[model samples]
Target chain A: MNDVIKLLTSHRSVRKFEARELPEGLLETLIKAGQAAATSSHIQAYSVIRVKNPSSLEKLVELTGGQPYVASCSEFLVFCADMKRPLEAAARTGEDVVSGMTEQLLVATVDVSLMAQNVVIAAESEGLGICYIGGIRNNPQAVSELLELPKHVYPVFGMCIGYPAHEPDIKPRLPVDAVLKVDSYRDDETQVAAFDSTMHAYYQSRKGGNKDANWSQNLTPLFNQKLRPHMRDFLIEKGFTMK
Target chain B: MNDVIKLLTSHRSVRKFEARELPEGLLETLIKAGQAAATSSHIQAYSVIRVKNPSSLEKLVELTGGQPYVASCSEFLVFCADMKRPLEAAARTGEDVVSGMTEQLLVATVDVSLMAQNVVIAAESEGLGICYIGGIRNNPQAVSELLELPKHVYPVFGMCIGYPAHEPDIKPRLPVDAVLKVDSYRDDETQVAAFDSTMHAYYQSRKGGNKDANWSQNLTPLFNQKLRPHMRDFLIEKGFTMK
Candidate 1:
């Protein structure tokens, strides 16, 4: 495989980071790389909030479910799905802009995710570690207030980027056959079962066998509980009326 | 910039493609690279349907609003936001799975987009050209039926990958300052105005000055028109209630 593909496959989320800071202007460079990602219809409907204030970072650490890396990382950015700029720009053209459509939400969300993934890749290429903090969603309104996010702009997720202090084992993924279908959707029960065994072994052998749960069991908490049930009303309140 | 950063920043959507097939096993390698992207809580809530049949490709061309490249590209893939596998697996573990949370939708959509971006980067690194077909969302239900996608699975977007027949100029993006804020959100009207001028020059000079619209004017149709208003109901019908 090529170096790019090799780098892509070798990814693992890093939680522990070195105390050192990023080189000058590297964060901006990475964000510029992120802006290079394709946006739907050229509507660059996303924003990144870089938190450098130690107090704000500490506040974000609490807001993001106590993830210490939120404060510890050399750079913490909250990627926001923003329709405000585009809608305002279009409204300036006297085109009665539609503000809160479901497609608009989807487009902005996809745009930000694509952009953030590019930033992650660029950071990894620079030998920096990065982790996406979905925990930011646990308290979206608080995080929004902390960032002063305006209407039509919601934080999709936060990211922590810094030099790596620990190299975690890469988690195994589902078999390619399970996720990749030919021409049509196909049931992947067999593949999932096989992957369960694989994950069982992975969890059993990794880092002195500290964990015993398989992939499915690990997902149990996510599905069994009403996880983040507030997201719908929260998004709607933020002007993403899914109607 | 490093080669990887250069590659990430040089991305442009390639529509017209050479009539050539990809090297054997390369598509899977690209997809494997895609799976390496970080998933929320390791849910891996996504799947890819590789559409190879000529008839199906032609149908997708019609479904995606006369995008002939859907049929012309060497490979077409429908990236789906999938919760079926995870929910089913979790249910098998004797948990009453709660599906259709808005957070689930966000997670799966983000997962697929991140995964697809990785595939795009990997493909580009191998000198292959690619385009993201967001038009697939234009007729999600029809496309889903065509691909036999079941409940708890929805097509988020499609992608076309092939050798490039023509090189398109990389579209300019919003100023990094416009999108990146420090510590808090900030107004970007000045930056947006500057970028509008930048885009005006870009449109006036690129490819023999074929286009005249600036970035703001370009987004008017997308914002003024009720673009893809049916997506909300369609996704709801597909069991993504976004509740």
Candidate 2:
């Protein structure tokens, strides 16, 4: 494989960091690389907030369900899906802007995600380890208020970037046959069953091995309960009414 | 910049492609690279459908707002946000799975976008070009029916990948100061106005210099109309009730 493809395939999330800040200009270079991702209709509907304050970082750690990496990492960034700029920009052209269509939410969310993925890849290429803190959404309102986000913008997720303090094995993904299909959707129950065994073995043989859970059991918490049920109302209050 | 960072920042969407097929195994390698992206709780809630049949390609071209490259590209992939697999796996463990919630929708959508971005980067690194066809959402119902997608699964976007038939200039993004913030949200009117001038010059000097528009003006159509108003109801029918 080529260097880029190799880097792409070797990704593993790093939650433990060495507490060393990045070089002065590297973060800006990474953000510029992020801006190069293709956006929907050229609507660059995303903004990233870099959190360097110790008190704010501590609050964010509590807000994100006690992910200490949020505070311990060299740099913490919250990626927000932002429509405020686009809406105002369009309004300047003398158009009666439609604000809360569901498609707007989808477009902005996807735009920010594509941009953030580019940032992740760029950071990894630079030898910085990173972790995506989806827990930011567990308390979206507090995160929004904390970042002083305006209307038509919401925090999608947060990312922690720094030098790695731990080396976790790359988690194996689902078999290629399970995710890829020809022309139509198909069930991959057999592949999934086989993968359960692989994951079970992985959990038992990793660096610290006292776990006895398979993939299916690991997914129980996410499915058995309503997750972030307030997201709909929060998004609506933030101007993505899903009309 | 290093080679990877240089590649990341030099991306351009290529709509015209040479009428040639990918080598036998390259597509799978690209998908493997895509699978390396991090997932929320390792849910891996996504799938990809590769459409090669001419009839299906024609139908997709129409479904995606007549993007002829859908049929002309060597490979056309439909990236799907899929909760069905994870939900079913969790249910098999004897937990009563909550079928749909707003967070589930967000997670699946974000998961698929990250994976697809990895695929895009891998393709570009291999001397291939790609274009993201967001038009797939224009008639999502028809596209889903064409792909026979099940409930709890929805197509997020389509991608056209192949050798480039023509090179296009990389489109400039908004000024960096406009998107990256420090600690708190801030308005970027000054930087945006400066970017307008940069884009205006770019539009005038580009190879085909007949177009006269700035970035703000280009976003008018997306906001002036209720674009894809059916998406909310469509997603609801697909079992993503945004609960």
Candidate 3:
């Protein structure tokens, strides 16, 4: 296999990082490479905020429920799905632009995601370790205020990039049959049951303290509890009114 | 630059493809690479449907408003944001899982986007061209019925993969400063104005037929008129109620 394929296949979300910053201009180069990702109709509805202030970083750490890596990483970026750019551009041309729609939100979210994944691949290629911080959504409104995000912009997720302080094992995934269907969607209960056991073994064997839970058991809280239910209202307030 | 960086930065969406099928096992390998992507809470909430039948392909082409490449590509797969697997797994364990929430929708959408982009990177490494057809959202319901997608599973987007018959120039993006901010959000009016001219030149001189529109002007239709406003109600009908 080629180097790119190997790098793509062997991705692990590194949570620990060495206290080393990237080389000069490396982050800029990475972002430019990220812009190379495919955008729907070239709308490119995404923006990334580099969190540099110590106070803001500390606040975010607490806000993300004490994820210390948010502050410890050499570089932390909050990726935001932004429709304001297009709205402003259209408005400048005297077009009465629609600011909020479900399709617009989906497009912006997909756009940010495609760009962030590209950034992750590029970072991994440079011997850098990276992790995606979805916890940013755990407190989206506060994050929006902290990052000074304007209307039509919402922080989708945060990313940590730095030198790896530890080499975490690549976590196993659902078997290929479970995810990649031939022509139609089929139930994969058998595969899911098998994967639960595989994940159980992985948790017990990994370097981190043994977690006595399988994949299904681990997902109980996320499914049982109302997970960040305020997201709909939050998105509406941020100008993704879904009109 | 390394090969990975070069491959990523040189990405161009190829809508024209040669009539050649991928080698057996390459698509599977690519999907495996995609599964390696980090998922939220180990919930790999996604499914991929490979459309091979000529009749289904023809229907998808018409549904996506005559994207001819959708039919001519060597392989076409629809990346689905799926919550059915997780909910079923939780249900089997006798947990009363929450059926629909805004957070679930975001997680599944982000999960599929991450996986599909990895598949794209893997395909590119193997010298295949890929295009993401967001136009599938234009007729999501019809596409879903054609693919036999059950509730809690919706096609997020369709992807076309094959060898490029003709190389297309890499599309230029907004200036990095416009998207990447330090510490906080910043207004990018000047950047947007400058990029409009850049895009104007690109459209007038590109390999495709000359178009008389700038980037802002091009976005007028999407913002001025409601583009695919039916998505919200449709998502609700498809079990992503976002309640």
lDDT of 1: 0.94
Give the lowest summed-lDDT range of ten residues in model 3 chain A. Answer: A180-189
Give a tens-digit lDDT track for model 1, residues B18-88: 99989999999999999999999998999999998899999999999999999999999999999999999
For candidate 3, lDDT tens digit of each residue in A118-142?
A: 9999999999999999999999999
lDDT by residue for model 3 (B1-243), tens: 777889999999999999999999999999998888879988999999999999899999999999999999999999999999998887777878897798899999999999999999999999999999998999999998888899999889999999999889888999999999999999999999999999999999998778988999988888998999889998999999987
Would you list the clashing residue pairs of candidate 3? none
True C-alpha contacts between chains kept, each model in order: 0.90, 0.89, 0.82
Q: After superposition, how far is residue B7 of candidate 1 from its true place, in Å?
A: 0.5
Give the count of colliding residue pairs in each prediction. 0, 0, 0
DockQ of 3: 0.85
How big a share of the true inter-chain contacts is recovered in candidate 1?
0.90
Worst 10 residues of 3 chain B by lDDT: B87-96
Model 3: residue B119 alpha-carbon error in angstroms: 0.5
Instruction: Give the chain B TM-score for each candidate.
Output: 0.98, 0.99, 0.98
TM-score for every candidate vs. truth? 0.99, 0.99, 0.99
DockQ of each: 0.91, 0.91, 0.85
Report how far off residue A28 is in candidate 3 (Å). 0.6
- The lDDT of model 2 is 0.94
| Candidate 3: stretches off by over 4 Å | none
* Over 4 Å off, model 1: none
